[model samples]
Target: GDQSWTCFLSADNFKGPIAYYIPETWSKIGKLFNYPFLYGRGLDARPGIMGGGAMEINTVPCFEATDAQGRVYSRIPKLQFPVDAQGRAYLVQDVAYYSKAALYDAVKSWRDGGPACSGRFNENGCFKPKLNTRTTRYSQAGKRIAGVERFFDTRIFEGNVWGLQWFTNDRSETGVFPRYFKDEGEERVVAAEAEVPAETNLLVQNFKLAKQGAPYTSPTVGAWANPGPKLGPFNVKLADGSVVTYSWYRFIDQPSFQQYRWSEEKKAKLQAFVEKLHASWSIDRDYMPPPTRGRLVALDPALLVTPPKGLEVGYVPIVTGQAAQ
Candidate 1:
């Protein structure tokens, strides 16, 4: 139970136009809006339970805009990041719950740079700007709606930029190795089903025998591999000049050998290994945290920002074995 966990927000955490727009817009209207209260309620509701929390919040911001009738409407902005076969990330904005005619006008305005409704604006006028816009159909709020979506090439940005959710436990090899490496040895069998020349047939037979005699050796010598490098001790300075720290380690799945033996000796060895690792290693740049649904900013050691106070350390136990389930 000596384990601990903590979360921190860094400059690299924000990605895409919203990332820039959120802080900038918030600077202008954030004071008028109760962000902290809303955030608390959102956290309590626990939306996207299986996904990263704050990252999901960034994708949908409560945007306020006015219509031609001078009516103000507030809606959560829906964004999507679709990656192509080449591994390029693209941003798609979905305009939900709008009339078909209005959606058409919005797309046309964004594409042709004519008088268009600026959702970012609270006033009743249209702005002219060049945009690579497209029309797409998607289901939203239990209804099929037509809306205009915009596409942006995110590679131009230097820091954390938004796109699709890339990091998940299924994709990360934090405390685990590939299943192919789990087994030992290889099998030898008939090389060809068709008949060949006598000399060629003899050669094939010799090769099969040779393979059967030698067999294949497994790369893994033992049941479990070594624990990867330690991550964090990420320190954030509070607005009051106080500092908080966070750290993390991957919990390896229990090895096949230890699954049946629930002995104290095995537990003691595992504990010792964790303690030794904590005492000795640190995560290197080569082993940076995997890309997540949210953007992560690499902090500059020289410039520090004041974070909120009373941040508590969280503990995530990386359990191993069948008992882990």
Candidate 2:
């Protein structure tokens, strides 16, 4: 219940224009246009790093099917992530969840064509009309949607960022994580402002996993901090003076790992892989393709732990913040 779940899609392997679609009814001008259609375009692809280079960007809309009345089924249901114009569903490429059941439901929903329409602009995104039933089946889409099940085997590291933990129990699907970690928790009442040693590199520890350099935290720390049940609830002050609360969980014992049909082999393998990641992957390391432009940032800055007094390097302290009293 500590962290927020995010679904990040990559266009690296996408053959052509990278884009996503939304029903016309949902777009700002959908009603004005009066049609059954999809409004989508190749989202502008910016360089991962600043001033990287120029790249092709595309913007295209879709109007596949219309009714006898010359009206398109424009009011079709909202869709989930990884959907295509043909009505095929796909799994999130890089995602983080609070628990295995949550992960399982996400995958199952995609496999089952998801809800016909879970309502517009809802959490899980919108549900698309299955245009290509032949290929929409799990058997057909499974290979393309591969690796989602693999998450079932990995340990979930959970935590709340800037007090956004509400999403974990938030059934409304309206909760969202803050874009920037500002030191406004005191005013927000989600978290109380706290302090660490004046010399504590809060920026580095807070953004420790970020790929961007100075002013931002380095990806690699001098050594790994300890992880434990008693770890955080720690208040982190970022370079911009925003305070964020972070918490960490033991790799395996974290609640999300509990409900699965995992084998000892798979668990051990994943554990070993995590160890390897800790040892070799620097906070600034480019494990995945670096975006062509714009500086890279951490997937979740909360992953790193700044150990409290007397703790040694091998231990990565779990981080969390104290709630406002």
Candidate 3:
């Protein structure tokens, strides 16, 4: 174990010049899935309400609108991570509609006398209160999020950071950080709308919506689409050198031209059919495989790793490497 200490910070509003003991061993790394995975969010862009004849995405006000409370949602807390479909990682914006809703609900709840404020203030006197008073984290009603899905891990500019939105030098020399949890000393608490986030507050509640993305859809599984066949969500790469995995919502291990003899007439017809299907699908383009000939590694279930007694399922005997079927 190791010992560490920072300046004791209670007077200035920060709960730390933190002091603590640390374990010698670092934890295992985790799978790199899509961060800020907004579960249950409708993938369709928010539609434009119209009084005219055209039905296009022209009328829906951007996520900056004042709510029932005087609190203005001027910015839809945009975040960016370097992950996307074309196997290219770049900074992108994600709006926490759910988080804003949770904040909105917490404000309403506080107005309803839900509970007292709970959280330590920060150096700037801004504290992101725990969301206990509102739909704490996840629920069916009000501004609260459904769960961790609503909460995404991202570099605040990683759109702004990536966009260089903060300070050119403040965020220079080193990367800033990500706010991923609701903390006040130790326990989690919700903040009322009346309370602004204190300077010391690191984590806050939030969510993602689909209107923030392109109106494009995913490809569908066809007779030609196969498990290892490449697909594009961001930029298409016939071949790339990055180490990654390739995961699809459904593996398209269907038959392709290989199953047929060389025939241009038949090939063109089949290609046309496949193209039509691509116009209306949105399968998840996850799973980056290790570099090789690009041949997929399928795992044989017969070799499934079983955990020893007392360990959680799939947590122990961690799934390592790609499947080599």
Per-residue error (Å), model 1, residue 303:
15
lDDT of each: 0.30, 0.29, 0.27
| Candidate 3 stretches greater than 4 Å from native | 1-164, 167-176, 179-325
Q: Cα miss at 258, model 3 (Å)?
A: 11
Q: What's the lDDT of the predicted structure labeled candidate 2?
A: 0.29
Per TM-score, the best of the predicted structures is 2
Instruction: Report the lDDT of model 2 for residue 262.
Output: 58
Candidate 3 Cα RMSD (Å): 27.8
Compared with the true structure, what per-residue lDDT tens digits does model 2 show for residues 1-325?
Answer: 1122233333332211112221221332444565434233211111112221121223212112233443211111112232234322222122222232423354345434554321112324422221211111111111122222211111112221011112222211222211111122122111111322223222123312334333322122222232234355456655544555654444543333443445888666555544443444234323223343334333334333445554332224333332221
Error of 3 at 94 (Å): 17
Q: lDDT: which is higher, 1 or 3?
A: 1
Candidate 1 residues lying further than 4 Å off, grouped into runs, are 1-74, 77-141, 150-263, 288-296, 299-325
- Evaluated at residue 58, the lDDT of candidate 3 is 27
Task: Between candidates 1 and 2, name the one with more favorable TM-score.
Answer: 2
List the lowest-lDDT window of 10 residues for candidate 3. Answer: 22-31
RMSD of each: 29.1, 26.4, 27.8
- Report residue 235 deviation for candidate 2 (angstroms): 3.2
